[model samples]
Target: MNNLIDELTPEEIAAGDVAITSELVPWHFPMMNDNVRNDAYEKALKAALKNGGTVLDIGSGSGLLSMMAARHGASHITTCDFVEMVAEKAKIITARNGFADKIQVINKLSTTLVPGTDFPERADILVTEIFDNGLLGEHALVAIEHARKHLLKPNAQLIPCGARVYAMCIESSEIYKNHRVETISGFDLSAFNQFSSYEYSGYHIEKSEHKALSKIASIFEFDFLKDTKDESVEITFEVTESGLCHAVVYWYELQLDKDTIISTAPYLPQLSCWKQAVQLLPKPMNLTKGETLKLVAHHDNEAIWFNRL
Candidate 1:
């Protein structure tokens, strides 16, 4: 039998391991995007220090935000993650940055740790970098709500209190053709077209503006602090041209406050985990130059959601 320690990989140890009813596996593995995410954290930290309150980084991956909180002159700080390895590594990172004494690292989910109860004190500001392209798909709202209920003070601030999603049309003729399996060795292999339009992942498509394509829809934006947790949103978009509506390119801009805004959508210089969630519309809506494209964005109960046009 493989012991937990002996079975673990280096990445597993650094990312944080979790245990279910039957087995232990790594979870919340930190894939830090230094370009987009780190910059957002820096901006959020600056905003958080405006109030000069105690801070809590709900998912303190790599302790980057916690260290930023200390540097920004936060009075006190607590950082937690459900993954034990991540929390432990965050402590190391904080110590290396000379913030070990200012920030307390906890290895537990936000729900399991209660401020002024399990935690040392209530947090005056709750900061987290748990956002995905469309927000709720990553369960960012659920995590923030958990921290708000158990760990935050009466008027705690939420970083990126809200986010807006923008989407447009894209074409990938090569991608669709690559998935086509034709006759091989005198055998018919055309059955693979069934998955031809599966555009769940990101790809590098040469930027082009075909007159046949235009914005098809706008998905519902998310307000992390004010929206209901059990809600699924659907948005419809109109197609302005006639062509194969291959995919919907999505991006987001976050509103940290009334005055502070940051975006990582197309045309932005940096790319984060949100590298434009492309939804493969069911069929290439064959239309003329004036036909409208209708797209509906939906969020499933399990938090895995997508937009369709």
Candidate 2:
């Protein structure tokens, strides 16, 4: 009998002539390539563990963060992932990293964890990379709230202590193609484009592809240590340049601690795996300087969506 995990369909090879297999794990590529993100977390953990404190790592993909906590001499480290497949791999990876005894890997969601049953005590510090490009796209609000209620101490510190989401109105024909349906073969298929869908357009885009038509607007922010969060909100931005507004470009600033930070803004020296998310409007609208761009941003079921009003 063939198992699904063992199945691989012949497909075109990407980079280095390596065909992405069914066994291709999504976590590994980013974990290895995202040195900036990892370095930020590692620096903060090193400082936070200086005096030696207990740590709890949520969404502990491959147990890297938990291992980082362990490597830095945290008094104790506990990690958990929502999937059993990831948890099992993390368990083995943690051991191979010589952190088996220092860290504990649980194959369950952080929300399902109870202090008395899952650990001897609440965590003195909570660390997680539970964010997507749009910031709240991964249900960080719900998970962190639940963890605050049951998993963390009253005064626990948080790595990536805070985060902010910024939005900018843009004129990008290249981006509009991603979501809008145009005429196909000289036939009006526009009606068949009956619906629109949300998407994540990671920032492999060039600066020439899109022009910013507005000053950056701060749409959302999260202080992991203190905020419970509001998922639905409307924000307004004033156009700084006269242009056709085709999309909203959003990025994040992650405060790993007081001093370390990372951003996915396209203008930055390098882009992160969690690239800027593009929210394509239903159609292009001609916008002018000082014009209004009202946006409603919200999240449901761990997915974030943006719309213009």
Candidate 3:
């Protein structure tokens, strides 16, 4: 009789290997924001301790959050990640912390993990720190929605119950010139313009506090338990000051509650994977200095992709 837990297929092994070895150790795409995680962990632990039930940590990058939940008196802890290497490392870390018996690590995506089927049961508390800089970059919403529908108990508590995308215009000639200008010193290197189109590059904001160039835009929202509707949230921004809108500067603000919120904007002096998702105009729009850029943010809930128009 072969138990499901002991059955590790070749496909699962390959996926795990690629995610852990490549994503977790050296090139962590969604870099851990320790401050955010620490804050969320403390809050979740308090909630979990009060409830005193099993916990599930999704996207368990290094098993730190799961371990915290276990130590905080969660009846049991289950951690899952799509990346194999990260899961392998997390297993080691969990075992090393003497929680091997109490905590289980599964190398699978949250969407595929079923409660009572793949896991012991529906976790009472679901804790995942999969947020990106502006709550749009990581698959946080997708993972949360999937878990809530399939793996979480009816009354399960979701850490970071909801999140918002906060963004405002900034004046950064340095970043614009860096991306917009193609040739310099008599070189015809226009072919290098492709890098500017890629949205992965993190930008530098000089000031720690920023005045609203326009009102802040709310790109998306996620309430873990409810059915998430699909519709593009349209926010139009009139460029008051006419510099190149190299891209819309983006960041994230988390609503722990009505009173407690954690904001990780570029001006906040914190490092996070939710870097700026810039949508540079295909052609640089030269405003007469006061021309409004009229930026429209388009969000697709299914694929979890956000783009500016």
Using TM-score, give the best candidate's number: 2
| Residue-level lDDT tens digits of model 2 in 189-236 | 777546766565555445448888999887777777675544788878
User: Cα miss at 52, model 1 (Å)?
Assistant: 1.6
Q: What's the distance in Å from true for residue 274, model 3?
A: 4.3
RMSD of each: 5.9, 5.7, 6.9
Which digits, one per residue and each the tens of the lDDT, describe model 1 over residues 1-309?
Answer: 258767765655555443532133222332354445666667777876976889888787778778878888898888887776567778877876788789999988777787667668888888877765545565677777777777788777888678776766666555445544557789986676676645454542334333326753555566767645454455545556666766666666778766667675665555444555666555455655555555455554223345543
The runs of at least 3 residues in candidate 1 whose Cα sits more than 4 Å from the true structure, single-residue gaps closed, are 1-37, 177-199, 204-212, 229-236, 300-309
Candidate 1 vs candidate 2, TM-score winner: 2
Q: How many backbone clashes does candidate 2 have?
A: 0
- Candidate with the greatest lDDT versus the true structure: 2
Give the clash count for each candidate.
6, 0, 6
Model 3, position 152: C-alpha lDDT score: 83
lDDT of each: 0.65, 0.78, 0.65
Candidate 3 matches the true fold with a TM-score of 0.77
- Runs of candidate 2 exceeding 4 Å displacement: 1-24, 198-201, 227-234, 298-304
Worst 10 residues of 2 by lDDT: 8-17
Which prediction has more favorable TM-score, 2 or 3? Answer: 2
Residues 1-309 of candidate 3 have per-residue lDDT tens digits of: 245425655544553543334423543544444566476557657765675888889888788888888888887889998876778778877887899998999999988887778878888888877765445556776788888878888878887677666565654455666566666899877777776544434554543222335445656666656766665665666556655444457666666544456666665566644455444444544443444445555554533333545
